[model samples]
Target: MGTIRKGANGGFSGKAGSVIGASWKSIDYIRGLSKKSNKPATEEQLIQQARFYTIAKFIMPIAPFVQVGFSQINANTMTPTNAALQANIKTAVVGTYPNFVLDYAKVQISQGSLQPGGTVKAEVATGMLMISWTNKAIAIQNGQLDDLVYILLYHPELDEFLTAPEPPTRGLGTVDIELPEHFLGGKGQLWLFFADRKNKRISRTNYLGELDLV
Candidate 1:
């Protein structure tokens, strides 16, 4: 038994004189065929139009929307936490693809001395890490004058952490990022993580930077 009712199964029914079965010799045949009269179309013209409609109805439902976040990480080290040691960017996105909305809220960092005499920067080039901010606010701040800013990198797969030589400065108050050759191919996200000695007090700040590989 057919699932469709008579009129519900719309389309020409192969009628002898209608568009579906009309002959070129008939009065209702297409005038120029290609550039014909609009009164009634020929069977060939009708069939061509029907095919187009069927195809259009079949392919418009599944597409993907993707978003990306940029940061630098080292490709040769892992943090003490197993994930890459991370310099606090405070704004990194995690997971394969993420959906994020910024919420203006207060952030705070407890623990750790914030001496005013040190600096720190985070960078990444390869591997991944977990980033979260559910209850705790973002920790880590900008560098102060005459502080040693340390750059740390992490390699997620091997679970290692490597520290770069400190860049000596009086008040270079900004995170300087560099991608070197050791990273598998010297490409990808480089995570810069760090700790310093100059800032032993709890009030000093460290800064981190973000960059995308070309």
Candidate 2:
């Protein structure tokens, strides 16, 4: 411990030699003392961070599903699975259209087994919607792994329907869709289900829930 002193702004500060320091912010914060970097985060870094944050929010709910997917595909570890998932999300966001693609071959090892059970949650914010689910597949012994996901969105007021394909994730799965602000007051229905590697529907469709998009 170097020294502790009261600040003019009614705060407290502490110094530990010339290497670390502490400050009060309602609570004490201790951290390495160093000169702040003059360079700010680059545009590319900011973009990457934004993309990662958005993907994290989108995938957090389905993290369990992703883990299970990795396990079923014999990728029973975190390092590679996380790297691949991050790369996939980056590819999706960088493309003209934002949608996830599954690596079926990697996950198709245990095909034709039993279907996994899980829960899903859907939420809408401004111009975006997120769907996240848990990986209940792990609970099943020798269960059939879902190779793909089919998402169906229907707007009753506009009589419009949108369908998209999503990759199957382990531990949990999540997908983000872009919607117009006009859809705010509109009521809609969302459905999800598992499909085979050949793009064939396997499990019964699950009605995730209805959304007001407000």
**Where does candidate 2 have its weakest 10-residue lDDT segment?**
103-112
lDDT of 2 by residue, 1-214 (tens): 5455555444335665665545432454557667788899887777666666544543454443334333333233333246435544544344222232322212221122336346778888876778876655554522344456656666757756555444544334777888866667887777655645543324444566578777
Evaluated at residue 138, the lDDT of candidate 1 is 21
Task: Summarize candidate 1's per-residue lDDT along 99-197 as a digit string, tens digits.
Answer: 222111111111134333322333344432212111111233343444443333333343333333444433444443443444343223232212333
lDDT, candidate 1, equals: 0.29
Candidate 1 stretches greater than 4 Å from native: 1-110, 113-143, 158-160, 167-170, 175-177, 184-199, 202-214
**TM-score list, all predictions:** 0.26, 0.40
Off by over 4 Å in 2: 1-117, 139-146, 165-172
Give the RMSD in angstroms, all C-alphas superposed, for model 2.
13.8
TM-score of structure candidate 2: 0.40
Among the numbered candidates, top lDDT falls to 2
Candidates' lDDT values, in order?
0.29, 0.52
Model 2 C-alpha lDDT versus the unseen true structure: 0.52
